[model samples]
Target: MVATAETGVRRAAGTVPRPLRGTGIGWLFVTPFVVVFAVFWAGPLLVGLGMSFTDMRSTDVRNPLGVELVGLRNYLRLFDDELMRRAAVNTLVFVVTTLPLTIGLGLAAAVALNSGIARLPAAFFRLGYYLPYVTSIIGIAVAWRFLLDPEAGPVNQLLAAVGVDGPSWLADETLALPVIIVMTAWRSFGFDMIILLAALQGIPKELYEAAEVDGAGRWARFRWVTVPMLRPALLFCTVYSSIGFTQFMEEPLVMTRGGPAGATTSASLAIYNQFGSGNFGYAGAAATVLFTVIAALAFLQFRLGRSR
Candidate 1:
């Protein structure tokens, strides 16, 4: 009788019985991550926002209860501060100069490696390019600092051997920021290359064959097929590189100390300087500004990518 009823029900429904819905037991595995994120990431972000509005000095570390709210005065003071202005400009310069170079070089390298013309194993080439990224940033900075040293560095020595005098890279105000930009591009392009290479590989070979059948030249094929297909990956690399360049601090700190008349002081380094000078509230305000800028840029990039 039970079989008969089940058959009748299925006949009436015109389909077999559906399985029971999941009870969401799978979420139990993700609970630990949620808890950790709330405690660490979300918790400190809220605390930092609160600190940005108060007169919090480094000495008040022992007594967080003593901080007095100063409203937006710390933020307002940013406009009148010359050093802050310079830092912001320097940061903008770094982003403007580094973003295109990094993306362009990365794309070029990815294309070259993908073409299989190098006669080396592709993984070997990828690992060689990505090695600097996994290496310590401090170590890279220190090594580059010595390599760019005016008197004894190999880079300048090579230039001298060619009968051309190289400028004091980190010591010259005019050249300090550019030197950092080059070093940063060299160390960071590998990640972009890997991402772009993946995007390139995912493009269907059939499209290229069709383009060829239509009598398109190599550049024409790449322009019509490769670029459009790789749009998402390119956008990701651009936005990621922008955020990294905006937050640049370590290289300048280690290599130039933001020196040569403060030519290389980035916004992040400015915040670090404020905190080092015991002005916690001021540092927090700078951080808040940086956060706003990054958020806005990311939103803009997302909109652009979606629209495209």
Candidate 2:
């Protein structure tokens, strides 16, 4: 018994358990990702955070360490900047307009697909809807530019046939932001559709059948059964869509260039402009503020989702 115990003790001391051995291998495989993430994401975030508190500028590029720390001065400047206020309002408007439209269209598409549509037709619809998302933003923007061209585009041509002159959609300050919102919604709805579709598929048909058997009409079943079952998915889509809409830069940058008196200047586009103008520290502060807003909004969304 002593020999057996000693042998077991020696084995335990020399070799890891099976579970621990597997865990060690898993961590080894994950180490490369950890290193890369730390180097690329975490490192830059720390550097940028530090930069936000300084008076760094284009001239400081050659002597970064020589830049003076300005503490909260950069952040204070953000509040008094009329352009920043405009950008904030634009971003808010964009988020409010696009979030509902995108999620609504996506939910509608997902429900249509989850219904009794034939497999082949549904597959085709899925492909058509999702195609825009996988396509390059540059290509999408170019296509939108062509389609919305005031004199030469098909939309205006159709309007002209009805004896109505279509205005320059992207160049008019009043119309530019709305047009961008529509474009963004069209490009984004497909992603939400895919997510909602997966969730819809996972829902058991039994619950739906029971609702029907209880004499619930289509709308009733949808309101009670479908909507309740889809809450989690809807929450996820809402939060994800909110964050994306808040940071939307490419659409405005490419489509309208935040033009026509900056009607379409989103927060991110404003930050990009600051960076381009070599106000690195100011840009950094703006970026940090934007990041905080995003994080707070996300947290609020998650809290609401949990409550629901």
Q: Pick by lDDT: which candidate is best?
A: 2
Give model 2's clash tally: 0
Q: Score residue 179 of candidate 2 by CA lDDT.
A: 92
lDDT of 1: 0.89
TM-score of 2: 0.91
lDDT (10s digit) by residue, model 2, range 76-109 = 9999999999999999999999999999999999
lDDT of 1 by residue, 24-120 (tens): 6546778899899999988877877888899999999999999999999999999999999999999999999999999988999899899955556
Question: Worst 10-residue stretch by lDDT in candidate 2?
Answer: 1-10
Alpha carbon lDDT at 239, candidate 2: 83
TM-score of each: 0.88, 0.91
Worst 10 residues of 1 by lDDT: 16-25
Clashing pairs in 2: none
Candidate 2: stretches off by over 4 Å: 1-26
Error of 2 at 298 (Å): 1.2
